[model samples]
Target: MPTPSEDGNASATAPTATKCDSEHTPQPQSVCEPDHRRSVVQNVVLIASVTLCMIVNTANLTGVSISLPTIGRDLHIVEDKLQWIMNAYSLSSGCLLLFFGRLADLYGRKRLFLCGCAWLGVFALGCGFAQNEITLDILRGIQGLGAAAAIPACLGILAHTFPPSTIRSIAFSTFAAGAPVGGALGNAVGGVLTQSTEKSWRSAFWFLAGMAAVCCVGGAFSIDKDEPYQLDDRRVDWLGAFLGTSGLILIVFALSDGSVAPDGWKTGYVIAILIIGVLIFALFVVWERYLERVQNGSGTRRRRWWTPPPLMNVSIWGRANGKLGVMLIIAFLQWCGFLSFSFWITLYYQNYAGLSPILTMVRLLPMNVTGFLCNVVVALVVGRVDLVILIVIGTTFTAVANLLFAVIDPAAPYWAFGFPATILAVFGADFVFAAGTLFVAKVCLPHEQSVGGALFNTLTQVGAAFGTAISTIVFNAGLTKASRKYGVEVHGSVANAPRPAQLVAYKDAMWAGFAFPLCGAILALLFLRGVGVVGHKTGPKVVDSDATTNEKTVSHPWPTLLLVYQAVEDR
Candidate 1:
């Protein structure tokens, strides 16, 4: 095996055996190693290609929202069934993330990435051709599965390829920028397509399909190959995958379907599914813990068919500083606020403001533009500033933005309330997302990078689903109350509600949206303190005389904090 030098370059010659090695058997070397070096242009191409994939994925997420009304109208879809357009994608994507992340590590990042791109392209085209709501929903779910496969591998590839250097930081920043950029483009493109008489909503799906195809071709040529890493004697956790996916799907279904259920939350099917989902989720946690203990235990015992390597490194969460746990919670809450804003704002423009799809996109352009511009600033300042401080600031902005939305009148002028709110909301989200991604990447070990990325995105999707469900519930309740009070004829759907009822329901839902970010800000302030670096020692330490003279130990005051802070700055 080639030995790595101080600069992380692998030497061609193997090290000569010393007298000490002859005296005592040497330890086995690790199977994993970095790939052969590539030129600067190659690295850029790779980064750009992966960033394109990210753009396509995020664009699909937000772009579809703008096209929903058109799609529902064309397919004759009821309001109750409309949620599935987004929920199917979010649910499948969220549930399969960890499974695919682990699979990428066990197989190969490049292989899975290619497969995912192909799957994404195929299904995206399928979605464009879908004849009915059911077909479209199924296709969208499959498309999400493809996205889940690609996302983790993209992150892992970036993490492994770049290392801890300026290039790596730039790569991550560029990657981070894709979300907002794609979202902006998605909105613009969706609106333009929906307005086109010939293609309408289906045009958006065709565009995504073409984008994915280009990315797949570019990725195949650009990304460098690496050997797959697998733990000895361990196998894939099929049982855990089944339980986790099923439970999440059930839970999301319960929450989303409750909005349209005959009896709402108290509906027998909704209540039963919710209970079963909760129980199954509880069982999934217990099963994961059991498998974890087995993996960590001494000696090779007879392994059960259900047992597999743990999906996540439980130790990462259980670390003394608890930064990982805090980050996870922050991601969950922020996404809740972000998605609530994204989904409802479009509805507000359409139903209350009485804007066309193109007009709604035009009005919401400020948020997208702000998000894109702020991400550029984040890319510039990320490493120099403290990550916790960035997070706090971002969440603060998010809370304020949501609060503004909660109080704004339906007739409020664009410049007065809408523009400022848009700017603040997007700015906060971009900063938090960019900083949070770098923090997780810096903290995780090389092998765990894919899973780390998976965890981050899983929480994001699940949080979005949660936000949509909660907002729908609140909005529906408000509509019912307002209708009864004013004696307006009530329907089960928001789209069918009277104008006054829609406005009232939306105001109440906006208040709930405000709470998510506020809670996130409070949590960050209370728990996010001090930088804690894992695996590396901090500060100076005395050297022992008996220790080898060539051995070196580098330390920082708090290594985790410094590394993450530096990582952000370098970006």
Candidate 2:
């Protein structure tokens, strides 16, 4: 059954159509936006706060890769346990995102957003002071919980407040640009900070914690607070949240652990966990459908705790905007491609190419430069052209780039193969990032915007976690085979071990890395083709409050402008 938000153009359409006589209807008391100038100031403050937070979060995630050797040496971390430092964060964040996202909708977004950042600060600080590997791993997981809450809301806030197509497009382009840009900057930051004789790996986490603390304070002031809006005040579904979160966590956990597990897929525990996770996910779907039935029969017009009707509405899927999901998936695949290769290429540069930690950082600069520039280029084009075409073009180039990387032999020169590969992959991902965000922004109704934004961000992160995990499994499997064939044990110091056969093993592992981007390109081509539409072209320029009847009469989109003043304020 369609709820108020699900219908997309019922009660909400009335006020938008009925123009204020400047006498009959009174404006709601403003929480933040009073004049255009104030609104612009508030928006800039909010964007700056969120972008800084994103950079810190990303730096914390990636900086450890370079510092891992120093950390392992100090903590006496075994070869098998090293990955957990990374997995602890990824698993927690991916699993908890859905629950936290729904909570943001039910409660106030600003409240959760602030809370998430505060918690991130605490955990990041704890991670820096940890004395043992287990302690660090546990602290990292706590840090991820905070990130899960904060990251999704960053996009949600923008989507809900920014109703203008042009402004929203630019906002998301900036948001998408933060991750890769942050990553590049993070690697450089990590390289510089960790380059000491004191071996100060702890400084990375401390830096993250300090940055998070500052951002959280600024964000708290920037956000406008009001009486929290409720979708329906439906009872929160603990059972569904539990099942969904646990299922995702376990699946990611199993995959991340697969590299260390003896016998790989043959291990009983791995298979069992994988099977259980799938079953739990299936149960979550069934439970959501059951909630839908119960709510419909109870004569409640509002959506229930699970499966918010706006997102589940079949009609949205048929719209050109719905193809945004397909494009997002492509974006997911491209990142997955990058992560898969990155996990191996880090070794390639160090082991085969004989580059130092600092040199590896320097060499990857081309990729980062291209990615950042491409994002700006895509954002410019989006203000004028079709998002679907931009995404397809990006994915096409990205796929070709991955294929190029796949064929590079052991003797391939850096300029001949590696440099071009970096440029191509960065270009592909940058285009997809900008275009996909715009597509999602255009499709969603105002009230349902948070969930839409959450889903969009969630899928990309989930894909990254999944891709990284899967590539680890593939790399390990290839290493195990190479180890057996060459009559060497695959145990101990993978990053530092120098053996002729081990180099071959690492190369073989990288060979399997090409499959992710290839599969991603195929998925994008198949699912997202022919989804272009002319948006905001024929629609009313601005919603007026005096023509409620007229607003409902036209088949045009009903822009929910009740609290959208912040988005229109000139930046």
lDDT by residue for model 1 (288-356), tens: 777766766634644566667767656555322576678878888888888888777877776568688
Q: For candidate 2, what's the RMSD?
A: 5.6
lDDT of all the models against the reference? Answer: 0.71, 0.60
Displacement of the residue 319 alpha carbon in candidate 2, Å: 6.4
Error of 1 at 237 (Å): 1.0
Count of clashing residue pairs in every prediction: 6, 9
Worst 10 residues of 1 by lDDT: 539-548
Candidate 2, after superposition: displacement of residue 416 in Å?
A: 2.6
